[model samples]
Target: MITLSLIGIGSGNPDHVTRQAEAAMNTAEVILIPRKGAAKDDLAELRRAICARVLRAPGPVVREFDLPVRDASGGYRAGVEAWHDAIAEVWAAELADALPEGGHAAFLVWGDPALYDSTLRIAERLRGRMPIEVRVIPGITAIAALTAGHAIPLNAVGGPVAITTGRRLREDGWPAGHDSVVVMLDAGQAFEAVDPEGVFIWWSAYAGMDDEIRIAGPLAEVAGQIAAARAEARARHGWIMDIYLLRRAC
Candidate 1:
């Protein structure tokens, strides 16, 4: 039986890693890291750094693999399914080669796995093929990092908050019954799709990292600045991970 630990490493900051996550990494017999191409080399590097920092002098064997690229030619849903299938196959091959005999292995995930991440879903594919026992060590999420960076509460007193993705915010518009919305994976500035008036936005890029950038104000006043800043930051760093909170005024 292969015990796979899906450990969340939190945002880019090394210190953001929890003690439990560190312990998991140190105890693993093999650690699998994914290299997501050149533009996101820093992401892969961060995982490696975490391993280097936490593992003992004679640490677990670290294996790096090329991440499969998602195909965008077909319909969005179909393309995602195909891409996930390919990723599962790659993971299976890696696991087989690394641990021909079932043992403990770990994969360092960015942010919390339960939030907008597909690692768990992909791991489900590995079941039935082999005896796989999965463990998830929760790490800080980007939403928590975003709120912490700004030193603000996630929700107003006695009110509810909606957490969603940029794609949904763009496609479905603002969800009902929640005045505050937290948006993640918004590479396209989806806030423009909603009515900017009477709304406030607190945006952060590379949240919890050394080169973090933050912008906040009324949506009408700062949307353009946030968009421009996001573009500049992405150009400068070759990649960006951002999240924001929006609240509609009464």
Candidate 2:
């Protein structure tokens, strides 16, 4: 049996990686890093840097594998499990090649595994097919990064906050009765569909990263600006990860 450790590396900053996370990485027999093509090669590079910075010379066997991204516009929803299953297969094949003797394998995860991320779910799928033990080393979350970067509280005093995806906000509309909402994994334009009245937005792209960008203002005024900036950044970097907090006028 292989011991699979899911180590959260935090949002996008090397400093965000905790000591515990580093310790976990040092102990693993094999560490898997996913290369997301050329556009997002920097992400993989960051993982490499983190490993190089934390691990001693002749560290755990580091291996890179191509990561399969979800098709955002897959026709009529082919289902998430379909995509996750494919990822699990890739992971298994890579691990079988790297750790034929069933040793410890570490998966470096971005952001917290329990929040909005899918590494845990994919691991669950792998467990169904293999005899592997799973361990999670929690790290900082993007939501926390967004809030801290903006230097603002996540919720107003005694008020409720709803955390959701851009798709939900666009398809379901702003959740009623929630004065504050945190959105992650947005398609970068969902705020356009929102009712701008009384809404304030704090938007950040690549939050907590070296190339981080931030914009904030009344939603009515900055909605277009955010969209344009997001598009330009994605074009410039070939990829972007962003999060935003929306609060109704109190």
TM-score of every model?
Answer: 0.98, 0.96
Q: Write the per-residue lDDT of candidate 2 for residues 1-250, one digit (tens) a residue.
A: 9899999998879999999999999999899999989999989999999998889867899999997777757653575777888899999998888888899999999999999988998999887777899999999999888889999999999999999999889999999999999998897478888889999999999988989899999999998899899989999999999999999988
lDDT values for all models:
0.92, 0.90
Predicted structure 2: clash tally: 0
Question: For candidate 1, lDDT tens digit of each residue in 180-212?
Answer: 999999878999998998999999999988899
Best by TM-score: 1
Residue range with the least summed lDDT across 10 consecutive positions in model 2: 70-79
The runs of at least 3 residues in candidate 2 whose Cα sits more than 4 Å from the true structure, single-residue gaps closed, are 69-77
Candidate 1 steric clashes: 0
In model 1, the runs with Cα more than 4 Å from the true position are none
Q: lDDT at 106 for candidate 2?
A: 99
